[model samples]
Target: MNFSYSFPALRGIQAGREFYTVMCPLRLIPKIFLFDEEEIPAEHRAQRVMNRSRIPDITNYILENPKDYIFSSLTASVDGEMIFQEHSEELKDIGYLTISLDSKFLINDGQHRRAAIEEALKVFPELGEETISVVFFHDLGLVRSQQMFSDLNRHAVNTTSSIGILYDHRDQLSLITKALISDIPLLNRYTDREKVNLSKNSPKLFALNHIFNTNCRLLGKRKGEIISEQEKEFANQFWVLLCNTITEWQEVLNKKTSPRDLRVNSIVAHGVFLEAIGIIGYYLYFYHPDEWEKYVKKLKHIDWQRDNKEDWQGRAYSHTGRINKNNETVQLTANLIKKKIGLPLTEHEQKIEDKLKEASPLGT
Candidate 1:
């Protein structure tokens, strides 16, 4: 047989199963790896039909930022024998693997990456030289192929958002969040980027998303949104003053109050409180810019002490009997804080406050 498509490969054995690893160039991928959508209806097909929509974003991400994106090796099952031609008689049987194009090759995983590499090659022809590792195994018919697909995905745990932001440098929000963590001592010391919810005993005062999202709100931006330099400076100023004004925050800064106790006993260390403060700060920023610092001093007056459950449970946690972070509770909190400091409430705020006032205040 004409072995014109042989690749220098490493031969390996796992669980008594023989597999071959080869680095396949981008240009040869489409020709060698066959994804049969038609085989899907036959139930004899090993791979599922490709989702056309997912390929474009992946291709675009690669093309837009060619320097940073990574595509892991593809796991494929060959329709015929993967014959590893021996190197020499004196050496072991390990040698180059000759895979033929004459037989079908089904991709058990990374079908999307294969499609994206093909698309990226069209846009950037130089990308054709780029190579992706391919792991080839014996033709495990349709049933085993489908099982392989399931087994591969079952073990894959998606990276969490905090971890994603921790590693990602491309998104503007992530960049700003990273900067804030670096510059703000409180955040740098007490933030948990890997978790969205800080545990009761966690030393963290805020989740990374909470800090990032609250900054978005303070700038009057949407979730996962970007902000300008002016808005960023304003948010920074707000944080500095808010921390300075809030005694608990400063206490944490001074080693006087443990973040764990503040988190367990009060709402000061929670996202809802930060969000509510962001909402209040929005009003001060817009209507009272000249008086912003003066109004910010009002944070000290907030009865953040959690033993005041009489006020907290009814206004913030009355619905579910726990910290409810929905818009309604957050608004009620914003209203309560605004009123405590004698800021005029909007009609919506007044209405929410009236409802909270009507509910029996939570018992201490």
Candidate 2:
């Protein structure tokens, strides 16, 4: 006289332990699987506490792209017995898994996805018909469940920013970056598309993420903003003009100098300077749009050596000579670039420059 829930599942054995993979309806997710409430302490739970802040972004993703969204299988541990009934001897592992209604179902991983699913179902109940896979393992105890959680996440590493930008088709900036890399021969030849930090011996001059970020600044586009065709053309023209104007960039392009040596000796070869250039480009685009080329060509006259302490030390690098990539340093570098191009700084830029002068009266 016991009630039970049954699911079509595929049985499998892993490290001498039996497990089952089952397709679960989204509607059943909220009713059957259980997660520890926020009140539970670390020692008593198998998984980390649900990150409430992350739920909305994920739920919005599901809601925004219902037809194309994908979610990985959820891993859970059942704290009670499961009965697997096979079709026949020929297909012993393929059948139905039945569990009593009284058993406890605990989520060991992917608690966020489960929470998002519940929220999405509330908004669009038709999505409840969709199925998400769940891998169930027998819960040995708190220790075993904790070990499973640890093992599951120990090898998980997030993708590098460059690779993320390279693969992302949804972000307009990512798409424009990829297009820039393709259209500009200098970038196509020397841009590192998959790594964030280039090694000492790496042949590439700039990271893909750096290009994306600098372009975002140059166009003054916020994240997820729609980019116009004219803006895309302007970005292409600006970068191409920049590559031709910068003496060292042209040197590296023509194989007259090595990227390693340029990176070692020049601040202009770094991402900070790339971003500084973008900041300057923003001002030029707005204030001197018709004659920005005349100002940009003046870049060839400026000293970009890392050892040029009077110009670069406090702006592009710390007093200790280490390159700094903070916003303040980027702004400081852009202020110097604006002066070199004979462009006037905005009130905000002038204030930042004034503070630096007050802090270092001797212009150290």
Candidate 3:
């Protein structure tokens, strides 16, 4: 004798195939649905291999925001016979689905959510009562299942980093960056809030994500750290002072120079320079706390022209003169700023500088 599992479901048809939508309790998810765990080759598997590294972060998200976390419906395929009992002739689509206990279930998507839910239930057992919607498709062969996965993800696009920073409410750095742009006149007038990369004629000096990253570096804080009011005020002051001190920044603010000309003529208008400035500001704000303004004013004297190859090549720009924002370049750019301000380089920074000197003895 075999037992059966039944669910109240709504039937639907797509591409001439029938599917059922049902609400499954969180507690029942781990017990019923299955994922391919065998170490099989990629071509033989219907789904991509599970990325274990992503599970903990997702689990923490669910556990941390127990009351307000949201998840989209899970999609799965059933590999056995299913019986649907209609309530009435007119309500045929709204009915109950019953399947044998021996049936195999394969998750077509939302495998990470399933793993996270399983982990969350261990700590918060009461959450087991909550229900999540599941869309069940009849067991097609592995070929069809792979096609379904491909078709589902084909058009999905990841949101840009700038927009992510613009809309985020939880990360303190994001909040601080937004507040800084609104409060600082130069930033308010020149920052691009939506797109990460500025087109040639875009007129904006910096992107929202770039400023957010610079703020993170300046504050010396991690992504989600709780920032104090004093810290927020300090960040505001730092940016305002930077706007007033940097020659090109002030020129743009005064309308004496257009953003396009500055972007084309100077490396300072780029995101790499913004991040390098953040690194410089970090040292000024923390180590030279009492006399940072004096050092910050020195930035105006630095040759910001893109053609100043002696100072900028291999630092702000690649040897080919293209702007580069890799870690080494940002650090090299910060080293130049520290030199201009008469600040001592850290041992790591000195080593990088030493290597550069070995590569280019005449400072080409």
Q: Which stretches of candidate 3 lie over 4 Å from their true place?
A: 361-364
Local error of candidate 2 at residue 296 (angstroms): 2.1
Which tens-of-lDDT digit does each residue in 1-364 have in candidate 1? Answer: 4755788787788779988888888898877887876645856666677888999889988897888778899999988755688788875555788866576788999999989988988889898888889998898677888888888898899887788878877777677778888888888888898998877788888888887767666777763456688777887788878777988888998999898988877888888888888898889889888888888897787788667876677656654557778788778788878878879999888777777667645411
lDDT of 3 by residue, 57-170 (tens): 888888878888889999999999898899899999999999889989989988989998999999998999999999999988999999988888889899999998888887
**Root mean square deviation (Cα) for candidate 3:** 1.7
Candidate 2 C-alpha lDDT tens digits along 1-364:
1788899999999999999999999999988888877788889878898889999989988998899899999999998879999978999999999987888998888899999999999999999999999999998998999999999999999999898888888878889999989988889999999998888789999999889889988999965789998788878889989988999988998999999999999997788999999998888888888998998899999999988988998889989988899789999999998988788888999999989988995864
lDDT of each: 0.80, 0.90, 0.89
Q: After best superposition, candidate 3 residue 229: deviation in angstroms?
A: 2.7
* Window of ten residues with lowest summed lDDT in model 2: 355-364
Higher-lDDT candidate of 1 and 3:
3
How high a TM-score does candidate 2 get?
A: 0.94
Name the candidate, 2 or 3, with the larger lDDT value: 2
Each model's TM-score?
A: 0.78, 0.94, 0.95
Candidate 3 accuracy as TM-score: 0.95
Better of 1 and 2 by lDDT: 2
Total backbone collisions, model 2:
0
Query: How much lDDT does candidate 2 score?
Result: 0.90
Task: For candidate 3, give the lDDT of residue 166.
Answer: 89
